[model samples]
Target: MAKIEPANGLKSAESRKSLRGTTESLALTDGEGNPFGSDSELNAYTSERQTDKYGFIGGAQQYSEHSAENIPPEVLRQREAKWLDMLNNWDKWMAKRHKKMKLRCQKGIPPSLRGRVWLYLSGGKVKREQHKGKFEELDSQAGDPKWVDVIERDLHRQFPFHEMFVARGGHGQQDLYRVLKAYTLHRPEEGYCQAQAPIAAVLLMHMPAEDAFWGLVQICEKYLPGYYSAGLEAIQLDGEILFALLKRVSPLAHRHLKKHKMDPILYMTEWFMCAFSRTLPWVSVLRVWDMFLCEGVKIIFRVGLVLLKCMLGSQDKLKTCQGQYETMELLKTIDTRYMQEGFLVREILELPVSERDIEKEHLASVRRWKETRGELHCKSLPRMHGAKAIMAAEPPSRQDLRQNPTIIVESPLATKSNGEDKERKKTKEEKNGKKNSSPTPVAAYLEPSEPSPLLKDTALLGSNQSLSSTEHDTYL
Candidate 1:
């Protein structure tokens, strides 16, 4: 392959001169075999300043050298070498370099390599190839009109600060609209959700429209099935699952939240729905995504647990919060330093979470969620969580999940005591009428309020059937 470098004096003046007029009509011609004409005269490519007819001296400024920050050049070279090897033999890499893949992903994928790596990790490339030209077919027709308007309104809201999506009808915005619309066409039952906008927008930043579309599909269908579905039932189920884990790991915080009638939905909806896109700092968001795409939803749960523990696990911090609303507000807006790219990446890797741990909890919590669906309702759980609460649907069958098996990474910290003995001791004390004298302050879960406006729109919430189909294929 010929290296395409600008006229930067790397070649001798003689060579540059010889390459000018000597160039042939190598380009494909028109129907008449006539070469396309250029209005500008074929001038010698030069680094020397040129004088125009008016005798004004002119020359282009030398281009500046750009490089990624914080990443050493040697490290980048090593990464490139590894990436090239993986690219050449992806199957071999997947079989023999699986550990390396996880390690490199944890170290943070090079920005230049992120798109290709993400496609490989998420199997987006396969999905894209499978549905080749499907995007164009979908693009030829308008999507559901209801979602069209909503997607249009939300386009400007996604990554507006980034150059790609900043301008109206810019490449970024156009591609975003096309991708989201195609999704609605592909899965009308889900239509457009507020959360999918940011997710798709982020993917577009990394890959081309077709690849980004498949990446989005992989995320919606494989990584986090049912997350963007009507009513966000998947998120609701995950939210309860998160709480169940929280109770085991951070009992004090769980008890405090229960006492104050603070629901996980109040703070966790964005974290789950958007995969922490709008919530985490931009740099941290990218790093989280690298792991999330490679490891699946377990990364989301791990990061979520870490964030919650840092935010609310401290007894002293919880003591200062005057009420549930203030605590929720505090939880919503965390310190920027904690979410900084380097620090957050370090924490995510150091956090004692493993895929095996998440799987076990996911299964049990899902079952518990189904059993407790009648007990939990939309009334007290904030409406911002989306759609309405409903009875848990039947879990995905085992056969459906055979294609995407969860990788089990064991962690010593995975198994934590749920404080069952403490619960028994407290209950025994209560039976002995010692509840009032118990040292720990008791905070009980609150009664339900009347159904909110969110639940009233159940008709528009649609069904989770589309999500269930994909969810079974990925994480059942």
Candidate 2:
């Protein structure tokens, strides 16, 4: 302003200063581009730097808009329900398939399912309660003297050689003792039998003590008739039945055995008697029990068939001298869990008759056999008594071996010397023809010498000689 001398740059020094102040003021603009009155004043306004024209927030906004326009809540609910139903139906289908497979398949039960399956099929649940109550009731009544003694005797003998269960104070032995004792108290009639130990041991695989006790009761009552009978008649009948089945399933092996005069009874008795304890692994035995509960007694036959079938293929490998040994070896070697489902199904599907019919026949046959034995007993009663009375009434004779005091030689050396002296005396007597006794020669007195060349040459000559040789040609 001092005449604002239209200075060189169109403004004087004062004008330039004013212009810079104006530009500075313009830099501090509000929303409407207005400058503040004071430089020290605080600004409280917010600025919108940049924004979309639509309410959408760029890429996210487009997706949000598309979803809001297209999706329905009811459709989502329907889809969720559809998937849930599919899962539920699939579970049901799987359950049914598993149950059927359990029944008809021959493979061993899955380890996870074994305990529950055994409990269900073996009537463990029902029998446990049944026997618990019944056993307590029977315990109050006096049991037969013979049965109590028998039970007591067998308690010590049960699983005598099984070291796993034989550790003095272990759980296995304790459980066994408890079950056997409980069963004895419960079933006064059957008491404790030798076979019960193996059966109990088997039951203990999948069950607690009380359940195993009841399972043993069920096995004794339903599956094995006459198993605990005094004379063991049922064991014989079962043997016969098992042999018959073996014959049907393996005729060639049967013929070979028959030709060799071998008895299946020799080895299979333990299998039939103990329910595969001696013949199968404990796990495999448990598997057999799994099928046994559902299929009844016939499972034994089927299992025996499978064993015999397995053995049939391998019979040629066995030496003829090992007939009984081979039969036992075969039983011991057979996989009890082989095609287990198929085996169970085949047996259940094709039993000789209804179980009820078999039960009836078995019982009737047992009764008849008992009656026949009773008749034989009655016929022989007088002779048995006469023999006993004759022995009792006769005066004590010199031949009364029991009355004669046994000479006890304290030392083994003395006993041996006495035996040698007696043998030498007997030999002298025999030479003198005092009696026609063949005395045992003194082994130590006999001198050792080289094997005779004459004997070796005679053996060789005998081998070389033809059957047509002269009658007088003695090789030695």
Give the candidate number with the greatest TM-score.
Answer: 1
Per-candidate TM-scores read 0.63, 0.47
Q: Compose the digit string of candidate 2's lDDT tens values, residues 56-114.
A: 11121112222222226465444434322322232232235434433432344433234
Candidate 2 matches the true fold with a TM-score of 0.47
The lDDT per prediction is: 0.58, 0.45
Candidate 2 clash figure, as a count: 8
Global Cα lDDT for candidate 1: 0.58
Model 1 Cα displacement at 206 (Å)?
1.2
10 residues in a row with least lDDT, candidate 2: 378-387
- Which regions of candidate 2 fall more than 4 Å away from where they truly are? 1-113, 130-164, 312-315, 322-476
